[model samples]
Target: MAVYTHLGSERLAELIASYDVGELVSAKGIAEGISNSNWLIETTGRDGTGARYVLTMYERRIDVTDLPFFLGLLDHLAAEGCAVPATIHDRDGAACREVEGKAVALIEFLPGVSPSEPSPAQAHSAGRALARVHLAGTRYPHTRQNPLTAENSAGILARFSESRLAGIDPDLPATAARASDIARQMLGGLPESIIHSDLFPDNVLMLGDEVSGLIDFYFAANGAMAYDLAVTHAAWAFDPRGETIDAAVGRALVAGYESVRPLSAEERAALPLLAQAGCLRFVASRTEDWFDTPGDALVRRKDPMEFARRLEFYRDAGQGAFA
Candidate 1:
């Protein structure tokens, strides 16, 4: 069953009707996400025509104040011809509205399947898509200030006490120690930019072999561009077993990205360490969420070691592999 905050089917139906969209044909929860409640809503227009849209109800995980930046970013991207969800305005011409005490928005659905494991070509396409987004976002009104810092890394390691480390794995303390040192060393060197931040394979959609659309802008923020690349690389270039799937794939992705915007020498130099920091961030978050969050079984965290391996590959092979 899909989870919801407080809104019910009947109330959602009323909200749609108020907008004069159509009769509510169907409203059901979507189960793929762990952060928020999503519903596939079907409606009939005044001419008795069927239309489908996605209705999203904000979850407690994200601050509601951040919604404007996310929604506006999507609108700006869609205006630039990017294949992202189109925000459907209400009768009042507002893209978002308050319903059942929760913020809600209806968006035109894009047709595509989420890639479980993207191939080299797909990863390259995603890299190019990200470049396009960055180009389009240069003039966006909102700017994101990154909250991650050296102190955050130290805090994460401190939170994973020796007892907890022993409980999960005896080597966890050593792993955390090494990860913290790497994070601190790399902290001052990474390049910064507006980034999607979370571009896991599931956030990207595939139509046959090409990238059809990008979704879930909840984690979108201004951070390190190389970090974004590293996150996508960690997601697409490696497998669940923590092995590089295809070196050519990694090369192709970087090539595609450079086709749009050339990477600075500084950006290129920091890619390896930025990738490492990205891995460490996810590892720390997964460990914390795994132990601290309620309904742990409901959330599936990816293997932290997979990202760790990608970082190791970049460290050993250097940028020549990507070149």
Candidate 2:
């Protein structure tokens, strides 16, 4: 959980006044991520509706200039039937407004719960929704390049070359390097579209056993659809230690994805490689976090080598690991 930026009540009231939403009744900082400051805002609007919203203060790893692209993509995907949060624009027709040099926006509060122990059916539902998201994303006008590419992965490993990964037998960096090279080549030919590049379990919300919403599109970009699936697989199929793969959940995820938009022969072949790259990419980011996150940052420091263990397992089993 994270709440990197703090806001006084007067400052929050000032911010809310800019929007059409009613007077702020209460605003509480929600500590649920490592990247930004978020608040669950409640208001009784001028329109006589009790409005609920999430106010996000863009803190780290997000560009203020790219807010339109990300928020616009959310709007576009929602129009296409993807259950994404709607961005509430200011009275001046701006979705993103500045708050103490940081970009901020109010998003429609989605009603649902993020499942802690997701079932195979939930995984399947998420996969189906993902395919629809990809399909609808074809019409989106905006695009952003994926930052977590093979080139970046190599750069990450190189930056941390001297550090030793604890509790893992064999040289892990070399394994990541090899996987990086394979992922780069194998994923090049798969279909590209607007993908929720960060479609992990936490990003999806469930109402009952069905997917009620998919949140957090900060990492959304134009990339291979299968790679998005790989990201989901790597995120959802892992145990808490990130060592064991939940084969049942993994199967449901892929099956549901393919049930909507069937994977091409090439995409199917590339799944293993994409999954490896996904694991390696997170390992790289978490490694950076382990070293760079400041003491005051209100975020969890995820273990980088947990992904290393996952990569090792995939390395031993190859494509058959997911099966």
Highest TM-score model number: 2
lDDT of 1 by residue, 1-323 (tens): 35577566688778887665788888878885656788888999657878888888887787888888888888988998777887888888888888767888887778888778677788778888888887777767797665554346557867777787556556456556767677667655444556787888788888976788889888788876777886677666766766655666677778778888778888888777777677677666666765775545764555545554565666677665465
lDDT per model vs. reference:
0.74, 0.83
Candidate 2 lDDT (Cα, whole model)?
Answer: 0.83
Off by over 4 Å in 1: 45-49, 148-151, 187-192, 293-302, 320-323
Which candidate gets the maximum lDDT versus the true structure?
2
Q: TM-score of model 2 relative to the true fold?
A: 0.92
What would you estimate as the lDDT of candidate 1?
Answer: 0.74
Please provide, for model 2 over 147-219, each residue's C-alpha lDDT reduced to its tens digit, 9 standing for 90 to 100: 8886687678666554454333245666655644755565476788998888888889899889989999998
